[model samples]
Target chain A: MVETGLKLCLKQDHPIKLDINLRCQNNEILALVGPSGGGKSTVLRAIAGLYPIQQGYISCQQELWLDTVNTINRPTHQRAVGLVFQNYALFPHCSAQENVAMSLGHLPKNKRLQQAIILLEKVHLKGLEQRYPRQLSGGQQQRVAVARALAREPKILLLDEPFSAVDQVTRRRLYKELIQLRDSLAMPIILVTHDLDEANLLADRLCLLYHGVSLQSGTPMEVVTSPATAQVAKLMNQQNIFVGKIVAHQPKKNISLLSWHDRLIEVGYQSGYDLGERLCWMIPETDVILHRRYQVSKGERENPFSGIIIDYMLLGGYVSVLIEIDKKRKMKLTMSVPLHVARRNGLKKGIVITVTLLTKGIHLMPFESLR
Target chain B: MDWESLLLSIKLSTLTVIFLLPVGIILGRYLAYRQFYGKSLLQALLAIPLVLPPTVLGYYLLVFLGQSSSLGRGLEALFGQTLVFSFEGLVIASIIFNLPFAIQPMQRAFESIPREIREAGACCGLSPIKVLLKIELPLAWTGIISAMVMTFAHTLGEFGVVLMVGGNIPGETRTIAIAIYDRVQAFDNQAAATMSAFLLIFSVIAISFTYLVTERHKKYYG
Candidate 1:
């Protein structure tokens, strides 16, 4: 029963409980993104057959790796999985070539070393093949681990925070290498990480998890901007999550009216919710457009509001400004603008500013307490 | 020194180490990685030989393998011989007495390996036996060697258990330690001194070799 993808549905309540359902097509990269202790790594371990689930059905390429009802479970080595651990657990006593060669046991003995050398070169570690894990730098050791994992030419690849140990610069370089490598790999790849930015940059789709429960799975931007629930919104770092009521839906104008405290915001058509229904809504910081102080702009005409700057922080080239829109409600909105734009507008604490929330970016979710 | 007794001691120590090597590895790895019911109790029971008087352990072994017990009688029926007062009996007692010496260092070594290394081995498609041979055994060799040395040295010097279970039979159970005691009992101080000095030197060399190898391994791999 050989197919071309992976499907894993697992449920367990004891001993590191988790509920996860995930799928990946051939050549797809799915990122399991969540907070620490959110069972992202556990999911990877389960897929790799290192962790046992009390009840589950796991199949790779339509071959059953685990089926609890039938009492069929394959041991880790029998499953065609290549897993890169967070610590890059390269054999300390083995050289980089030996580490990669260890995984090439399926090949002829004489060809193992040549294949390992090729894999090491693929990871840009050709000259360092003789170095032991202890002798290599963290980044080099990580590359050796990746080479070792890929040496098996496994049916699936699992990466558990593969870039977390390296410095930021090295991490960026590894991310680029992995992205380049993915094009050559036809197997499904699942990555576990707490870094949303890493997922956004490297993964084709992101699966959001919280406390071992998968909340949503979608493209990076969709999950970030149109989270299915408040929890997903919070997990995505959407700072503008708020509870609002659908005051009206104007079908003729293809618009909806959302009442946030004393304000009426014009949003894109949301057809499902009844009038006066309470719902959770969020707007991404990218969708909050800062109005030019010196000159008015046409983009400012949609969902325009004035607020006073409560806080502002410069992050690299962008300035994140938190503005309080309602003094009595203590409601605030966060927006990011380039540093040059902030400076030109004289943005600072206690300064009054006007911003427009894009009508299409006001995403709505079913009512849930923002606890 | 009684060359016959010294040779007997060497044979006994070598046999004990041979038998305990696999036992120590299997038990040590089990203790290192698993959690189960009665695990602590099993560990405490295994450690009794380290703290309890050798005579106490010997008394139990003597009774368990003596002629009056069913196990001893069954063994005698099967082999047409008694186990007590024999070289085989002495080896068994020595192995039991050196259990901690044979297992603790290896257990600590196995524990020192991070869990992810073994998982990585599995993920790399190495079978469990291959992982143990290519990954765990190489990493834990220092502790395994230490265990062997400690077990050999301890088996060579055991006195009370040998006396109780093997009954001072010359050329059979009269180890170097018992021979030293016998020489002293016979008012032969010079002979006792010779055997005692030999054992002292052998022990020093064995312990020093273990320490040197362990220190070198740590420096190279720590």
Candidate 2:
């Protein structure tokens, strides 16, 4: 297991302060997901000892890697950490075999070469061991970099935007290879990436970071379904977010009523929110049910609202529908329906359709929760 | 034509390059990778030799290493000879005169290497010294060769500094440039013309070799 708590003050035109704490168990992939300049890469660098933090304690498998309070900061080479840079960073002058052998410093010269060849074969670059970095394809170079990182027998693996440089097809193949590699090793791995879908597909847990702060961290489903704040919901691609006021609270029935832009919406009850309190709420596009206005029975519909379809787009397999509820104000909400469902319901622009905002999908947060 | 002067010039240039290459690499690497107070001042000081008249530098060296100075007197007491008007003084002047030619190209070469490559080496558990020898120096081979060739070529044709310090001692400090001047002053136009052509051809060959090697390496590596 690896645990870290770090604080740093970055020196920039406008300095950014970062404070984060996280842990990863053995054989788990903890992905740090965020947008540009969010300090995801900086966290990875700090763990690898490339970037020093002013105050922190980083330990791996009961061994202390860094403890600023105790003044114990091991040099990068002395720490058992492996980092794979975004550009692979293979020695341009060394061949694939020699590059891997560079990490096998504990072995004799001949044994180092032999072990390097073994690692190359494991990464499926056996016959191309003599090729330089320039001669290898992007995927091939990435595999070589991984093999070299593993050659050091590190206790933790840190990958910084590993697959962003490769093509989609190659990235998929590498994902499969990475899963296999992870299965064989018991060490904790931390991956830094900006691609949300990639993180959802690969990581066992996800940490959402913004402006050098980790907003929330949990399993992919928890972070995506129940965001802690409105900013996090937006980062998770929730398009239907707006401010609303608590109009009524029926505690006995376990439901609350919120006033949102001339509409009264019933939502699940949340504690600690008083009547007349302003809150931010979000609904995922997938939970916005689209139905033909004529077929929906009034008694069966829950929180059903009618709006004119202002625009519609057919995105390959699904159709993205944008509806304008208040035409004068141009208040819009977007939803996505499968192409077959859209065609069956005759969904199109300029037509009034009914969409139900699912009660369970309504996530509310305090107005000041973002900070 | 004195063949001994030609041989002496080759020997001097060779020795100067041998001693200058290591010093150049150390200073060049340090200047390329470090930042400190007075760094710009130090760089400017190193570059003065490149712009100053060779005789001015030679005059400074003459005063600093002459018998009257403490350093020269100490050396004279130890070695039984003054530094001025000796082969050792000519070598000292050549090293200072050709320093910028040797170091600037090397510094540029060392700086051209990406930081990621060095960090990656360190991450791979290689020490800083090993990284410099195994990774940085090999990658900077072109710059090193350029520095060596330029320094050697520059030393081969040194005239003003050698004349001031060594005073045109035949077979000792009379390099090709000095010999050409001496032949011209004695009205031996044919010998002077021959030596000038030889120097020109030698410089052209050195520069052509540099270009050819660098081009071939670029193509092969790139």
For candidate 1, lDDT tens digit of each residue in B1-222? 899999999999999999999999999999999999999999998899999999999999999988999999987888788889999888878888999999899999899888999998998889999999999999999999999999999988889899999988889888889999999999999999999998899899999999998998888778
lDDT of every model, 2 decimals: 0.91, 0.85
**Which window of 10 residues has the lowest lDDT sum in candidate 2 chain B?**
B213-222
Candidate 2 lDDT over B1-222, as tens digits, reads: 568888888888988999889999999999999889999999999999988998999898998889879988987888788888888778888888888998998998898888878888878888888889889999888989989998998888888898888888887778888999999999999999988898899899989988887787677655
* Model 1 chain A poorest ten-residue lDDT run: A1-10
In model 1, where do residues sit more than 4 Å from their true spots? none
The prediction achieving the highest lDDT against the true structure is: 1
- Alpha-carbon DockQ of candidate 1: 0.83
Q: How large is the i-RMS for each model, in angstroms? A: 0.9, 1.3
Q: What are the chain A TM-scores for all the models, listed individually? A: 0.97, 0.90
- Find the candidate with the highest DockQ and give its number: 1
Residue pairs clashing, model 2: none
Per-residue error for A49 in candidate 1, Å, reads 0.8
